[model samples]
Target chain A: MSVNTTPMPPERLLQLDDVHVHFSMREGLVRAVNGVSYHVDRGEVLGIVGESGSGKSVTARAIMRLLSKNAIEAGGRIRFRPEPGKEVEISSLPRDGRQVRELRGGHIGMIFQEPMTALSPVHSIGTQIMRTVMLHRRVGKEAARARAIELLERVQLPKPTEMIERYPHQLSGGMRQRAMIALALSCDPALLIADEPTTALDVTTEAQILELLKSLQAEMGMAIVFITHNFGVVADIADRVAVMYLGRIAETGSVDDIFYQPKHPYTRALLQSIPRLGQAPVRRLKTIPGMVPDPFNAPAGCAFHPRCAYAVPGRCDTLVPEVSLFPGDQSARCHLAGELPEEAL
Target chain B: MVGYITKRALWAIPTLVFVSFISFVIIQLPPGDYITAYAAQLRHGGEYLTEAQEAAMRQQYGLNDPILVQYWRWISNILFRGDFGHSLEWNAPVSSLIWERLGLTLAISTLSMVFTWIIAIPVGVYAATRQYSLFDYLFTVFGFLGKGIPDFLLALILMWLGFTWLNMDVGGLLSPRYESAPWTFDKVLNLLSHLWIPVVVLATGGAAGLIRVMRANMLDEMGKPYVETAYAQGLSERQVVWGYPVRVALNPFISTVGWALPALFSGDVITAVVLNLPTTGPLLLQALKMQDMYLAGSFILILSVFTVVGTLVSDVLLAWSDPRIRYA
Candidate 1:
């Protein structure tokens, strides 16, 4: 194959190709991320939207190679393009080895959901942030401290200098989240994976954090894989959205394609469930009927068939739906999503 | 933080006093008095004391005083004048005898604690990280064996091994060579050489228990999201294991320090007797058997103080290390 004349090489920062993550227990194996595939471009915020148990966090953890011992990556490849120069295989990287250590905070960084428990209780904010700075960057203590203060200020923390001396427990939820963000950005990583970073915060703080992440991503030009179950958050921040259902991507498209032109029945039900502001109150809010099928005992056909309103009676129950391209350049996995009634649209 | 430690230290005084008082009452509860034991020994030797002679002896020893008054006097002397009454067995000042033995016990206990922690922490952390691997399984087996086997049996086994395999003396802190040159390097090394068997035996059970505690604590800490966060922050596996979980696991281990202190300080009475090392544990046991109230009471008081102080120190250290902890 000849080298193609493609501009910017599509700037694919991280790509998961047909990834499958499963958990083996005494009972059975749970297919957590079943054949999930997606690509995060440089400086782009890719939102993984789904309800609880949709494998959004698992997908993010798989990218970072932070899965538990029970979690078996049955099949798939996670490749991280650190910069314009080289692409590294994340799945095959030797954990606890020197090579993985070098790449961890140097090329990739991660922020967890709960800030209360994320930071070390023993260390002060300054020391924790300084540790990352000194670890990756060959900087002295004084320089790292200065950089830590600067990073704290950049994260919109109050009194960055004084706050640095205080421990994580001394800070409120928003402050701790900011400190976590500061720690993540300290090494100037090429990829930032935020796994429900604002879920534990209040609504107002969540908005501020999301906005902070967006502004920071724009300034740093780092590809971010933002994991959340909130569709409203995806609407406000995602460049592209991947909707997960029963450990598989039911739909993947541009934000508009997902929000305005949803082609998957699961995605449509999720959008309908969102409590829209200014809408008249009703006896019961719209909800996707039935719960997610247990991952361990998932159905042989489409996992969403039991709950999908647009399910084709025999086909949806017997045949596993393949991921197929829809009309508006959107990808969906459903037997009759393209043939929905006009009024339902 | 220093102020917090100081406050904790101050609070320990009252706690120690209460513990000492209870220990004193417990010691006094037994029917036979120190004078009775002395009287029985005299009778065994066929030197029967007349009623007047026994009364004079009791008066001289202040044995006729009420139990509460005697306790108050003993406590007053210890707290105010630093005098710990004369021992009925050795006829030497109880404080002096206790101090000499205490210095030796302190050295052994300190060495054992250092050795146990150095060995246990790493082993526990390893077991936790490996979970059910071969190394973890081996340590778990060893840990259970350590916990189940009696301390005295452990000492006897060590002593037998020392005598048969190593051609070593199974006894006390020093060899006969130490009497000539007390502070020489050779004496110190010789002392340590003899000191280790008992210390190792005494510390083994504690170390094993600590390893189990540390393993459980580390496993718990490892499950905490903070540990995962540390790994996600790109810290090395060593950093995550030693840095995050180890520190948090210290909390449980620190609380156990109080319980371990007296056990360590005593240096395992059976081990001391089997090895013939004249540590305070065997001496205290002998004192109890002979009903040398002053000797036993003073030793018990010292041990109580040590237990109290050791716990306080660990608590303060824990508070200092953990930012979430607050001094009340």
Candidate 2:
């Protein structure tokens, strides 16, 4: 079959079409990513916001094909645009094949949550960074070394030449993360995946890392799928946001639309939970009532209905909600999407 | 590193002295001297030992000396003259007696160690990578059986099979022709042909235990985030498994090498006896049985030295291999 020859505009760099990831455990099948669909445009920072067990990280790993041994891609596709009008179905690629291998740290790169454990303790930072460079590029040792140093400099790690030879343990958490980012950007990937990259750092270090990522994205014009639980972080860095709840996308819109005009009851509760600056001192901050249901025996119908205060009693608890598209490229998964107020904040 | 090694070597001196002293004390714990056992053997042969002969024996061996004086004499001879004393059982110098059989024992033990590691490493890597698979479960079962069955019993079974089914003589480390022959190429080849019997007998239990240890270590290393990190780096599965987790897994395995070395030389006494191999194990056992204090004590001391040196070598190797274990 001939490929599409038309000079089509590149709208979205990566798209997940109703992807479902399940983990087969001794207890039961865990619905990790249940028909979650979203698209990340070129140079767009798509923030995936969710609490623990909300399947945001799993979704990121699915795109990267870095899920654990137990995980199963039960359904749907992760279609990545290689170039304008050209797409590759990541879900169809073998987990350990050359295609996925090239996709990882080549066309797409990932930086994990814990910088301390993300880099191998035995190898020097330069060697680890050079691994990506050597893997994706056809360069000799000397050239790869030069590129490694250049990447380190790009990540703004102090004394790139000297720091390249140093091990991960020698560097501070912030510096280690900088090195990790250098490793991720070594191949100049079209898309970057940051899975809670700053979760393990101090608040100050987290801000610095966020600043570095923003600058790098702007400099390279690369799309980023940033997974985090912090709404503040999404507000600061994200252009578009996808709010997930119980393995499904509850809402996807512009950051302002989700934060200021949250249609889903769950998103509104999450926004309420964050303590705003200059707010009155209170004994307790707002929290969604119930926990993420046990995945083995997840609640039926609308997963958030149990915890949602504005849940339609019989309707929300009994019937599963469908995606409702609004006028401004915003969508929500709720039965009362039309009836609910546009601005809850 | 040189300073650290020197410190370790210096520390070993007192430790070996204490170990030798303990062996001396323990050897003396048994009732009566070697003469008493000799005299009893004579009685069993229908020849009574008279009071005159008993007195003569006591005077000849300096049995009248105090325990501390005897110990001092023994230790002094070892320290100053480099003599390990005369063996009452063989009536030969301890050093010469050990030296006669040392080569054969070393060859067998070393070969067994090589075999154990060669087989165990790959099997361990396989079992760990294919964890919970049919192959892993089968190896696990075999591992337990190998560990549980006594080495002597296995030796006996192997001997029976070699003799009855294979129609082979599976005793000793040399053929009849090579037993008295010089160390020529043909003699060495003959020795090699017979060497496998004892080596296989010894390595069965060792390789099984080692395989289990290596598999456990690999599993642990595989679970670490570093392994996943390598995978995320776009490394091939082989590269990720061997180059990353297996390298780290080797630390614990290398540390066990010290204990393994001494065990090869001194351990598996029952297996040695059953196979009738001309190694130190049978000699040590006989010395202890006949209350040959000097010979038994020397054997214990040598084994202790092997233990110490083995541990030291493994420690240095571990420090060299694992960056996490840097010595001050």
Candidate 3:
């Protein structure tokens, strides 16, 4: 309960309490997001960092109920709290029900990885954005058009009027991404889920998109769930970071804490693997050994044990580690979170 | 865009020439000329064509000239005089013979095309969106059957059904009273009454094949990220299906228009024979059977023009509908 006096602890915008996502395949069930839990506060950016199969995107899609037909939310809850004590369990709602439809693009918006393919090539940029605006808001066509042009200008796309009439194929990659961002923000959604929005872009363009996103977040005061495989990006934009491995969160903390004082071996290995600029040209980049375990039949205990440099023979191979929280609101799901050596390599 | 269209039009000229040349050469490839076949037919019918008469007929028809000379004569008439020569069997101008049947052929082919697209687009979209559903499976069964069965067989079956159940004539494009009559309301009504059977038979294969193509194209488009982006925008299922994937999927289908022209015509021929419809298909078949090179060549030339024109139209439509293709 928020005390009238205490600065009502910045409202919890969205929360996921131990969510699980499973996809049924002919071969076997893929446990994509296994007991994953995290939350984003108002105006805060939470970066979910993971490899391709690490389930980061799956978690983001789970929040939006955008998983494919074969996917099932095996367990857990995704609760969105618009205000204190007013919660809607996203996991419990029917996938195609009107409630979820209203929640998407009305209260929540998403931008995808590839800008070229994310925007429909057959439609003009203005039409796509205006449709989104009209879908969520009761507005006239002229008003929606004005809002679209405004959003395009806000995203810093040049020639807003002319560009609105042009198709996605006419724009450069960065401009296309800007247009996509404009579409996502047309409704001024409360929560924005960006699934690797800059992965397909060049570094300069990626940085520009990230900068644009940060400024937009500042301007709109909306929470962002930024999913990516790049740690450098997480360090740049995220206030809090959640490092995922094998469909579970291995470590989560403030950006500084996760980068400077990583607790899990996987997180430490990930940090060491980053190719520093000043390193010797002949030296190979340090890589964590062993592949991610097959999802159909994951290892018995710690999923990272096979790849962890400091794996214990008997204990780490058998007993799954429970999430251990540290003093500074940081947590790591590792058996020897505190006892690992300082050096990762 | 005008420049592009002009370029396309200019390109079609050479294509048509090449097609006409090939058709002429292939039609001339058989061992004997129309006179020889005519004499052989007369012999079989217990009559005789004297050698002098055959020789005179050959000379008058330019059959005694070199093959190159004959080709030049044919091509020049088409290119400079706009004349397609005379039909050896029908004893009329090839142009008039073609004109006599062009109306019905175009009507049947056009109607079949319209029927095909009208059925394929929506059903294909449905199958793609609800893949693996019972309706999709059932539709797939129909598609397979439609694709596998020959058009002539389908015509026969439909004709049998119509005669047995509906007591309808089911053959020819018009009733006896309207066969050679002017284009009046009664004739039009009679034509309409008889048109449905051949149209259904002719359209089945194309419609079924197009449904499969459309379904595949739609499935591919559905997997593209733009579709997911549309959904994420909270567009309804109907809006998303129609707006993004359908538009993108239509590219390949539109490109098929060029090929569909020739296919519809050829398919119409067999169906026409089976149903005894008064279309260019039966005329073409008869001309080929009689070794009437000009008549057969004219049919081939007309079909070629339809193909080239169809391709041009499809290209223009593709450019207009898809911005990616347009800019490229």
Candidate 4:
């Protein structure tokens, strides 16, 4: 490994390698994240786009080793390199162990969809943020308080001093989200996992929160795994995009490559379905046909075969397609991704 | 907050008046007055009262007065002078009989109430966090059984069990040896030895109810985003479970405990009788049965006040615990 020769290949903070997360159910097993694999480099934003149950959030929780008790992430390695030379295998650590606790909120932080529910109603915003600061850092109460107020101000929440004394219910939705973001960033984690954080806000508030997050990411110089279903959100903030369908990566590439040159049929169908701003009006927005197959009774091979317009019947219906690699860390889990002529669709 | 409390306290006045009137009327509605029962008792004791003598006795006792006038006198004495009138059967002041047993009743109720929470909260929290585990299922079954069994029946069974297996005296607030003895360390020990049975009997049903309530409450709160948020902050599972969900689950529990305040005087009356405990519950039952109007009325009135006051206290505690409540 001639590592010293080539500008040290921008260090990878987190790399999820062929991870599989399944949940045990009374009826059967739910394969939430099936052979999912991706990575985040230092100070970069990786957008994970998917439907509600497509396992984007599950993947984020897998990286944090915070899956629910019935869930098992036993199949693959979630390697995290928080520092330059050190590596911690997150998937191997016990979900509720002391080691995971030290890793969470210190090396990685997460914010959720609904800020009102995510923030505790009983504790003041300051107490919530300050506790995170104090948990990871050896700081006195006053110092933690100072850091909390600073973080609150950094998120641009008005009235930092007054807001610190206010509970989550006292704030507006945007304000609560800002406070949550402040809490997540309290310990200065190297990576932040924001899982549809703007989904619950009004359009203006969502825009505000996204803008705030973009600015904060720029200022802190930390990697972000932003999970969202909104294509607009992905286009606004993502450097690289991973489009997921039925718990598998459909296509992953640079933002331009995903929007302009989608290789997988699922990704192409998703792009055609959205209502773009300048496009001519149509009778109806194109929606991908067929329901997402139930997790308990997933189809035999390609989970998306029933819905893929370009599915090769025998190939996609029986043999699961391996991820075909491409240039520039891009790939697609479809049998025909690399065939140049099929990219026209 | 002070103003809010003051407003609630003021509302209790008319409520007390209404309660007094209703309880007074209900006590009077029974087939006969206390004197009628007293006359029957005298007849059974081989003392004959002529009709004229009975009339003279009723007039002398002011029983012939209008019911409203009698009610006025009773309520006036209680309000202005703290006089609960007289107990016709006991030939003593109503206050004296009530006071003698009320102190003991309050102590027992408070202890059993504390016991219920101490046992229920942790057990409920544990069952919820370990949802479908062995202890969760066990407590769920135990909770159902405790709720289904009648308090008096449980008391009888426990009494028998204590005597047969433990060879322990299971009845009354004290042993026969310590019944009339002055307060001493040995007497205190004897009292405590007997105290546990009543406490356990009284606590069983309440503890069962609270455990189920707390368990359901914790289950609801545990899955709320805030608990996950706490864990996402890298908190240990213990800290995450105890810090937010447990605290939220206590809202209903504190209210239940507050409602138990009125149970101080009259909870599980039959159980008290079965155990032969010297508490207010049994005394109240006897008073009601004998149509001891003053004594019965006083007991009901006091219990009503306790209930209203208990609700007020619960509201205040809830506000203190949940910041969102202050706005509401």
Score candidate 1 by lDDT: 0.82
Q: Arrange candidates by TM-score, highest first: which order? A: 4, 1, 2, 3
Model 3 stretches astray by more than 4 angstroms: A1-10, A82-87, A275-286, A310-314, A339-345, B21-83, B177-190, B263-267
Question: What DockQ do the predictions score, one after another?
Answer: 0.69, 0.52, 0.64, 0.79
Docking quality category of candidate 3 according to DockQ thresholds: medium
Ranking by DockQ: 4, 1, 3, 2
Point out where model 4 deviates above 4 Å: A1-10, A280-284, A340-345, B31-72
Alpha-carbon TM-score of each model against the true structure? 0.91, 0.90, 0.89, 0.93
How do the residues B70-134 of candidate 2 rate in per-residue lDDT, one tens digit apiece?
A: 77777888889889977867878988988887777777888888988888888999999999999
Best by DockQ: 4
**Cα RMSD for candidate 3?**
4.0
Q: Between candidates 3 and 4, name the one with more favorable TM-score.
A: 4
lDDT of each residue in B1-328, candidate 3, tens digit only? 6777789999999998788888888778888878887898799989999999999999998988997798889888888987898887887899887777777777888899999999999999999999999999999999999999999999899889988999988788788877678889878888888899888887788889989999999999999999888888888889999999999899998887777776656546778898887778888889888778878888888788889988998998888888777777
- Model 1 segments more than 4 A misplaced: A1-8, A96-99, A278-283, A326-329, B20-72, B79-81, B173-193, B258-260, B326-328
Error of 1 at A162 (Å): 1.3
Residue A215 lDDT, candidate 2, scale 0-100: 94
Q: Give the backbone clash total of model 2.
A: 0
Indicate the docking level reached by candidate 2. Answer: medium
Candidates 2 and 3: which is better by DockQ?
Answer: 3
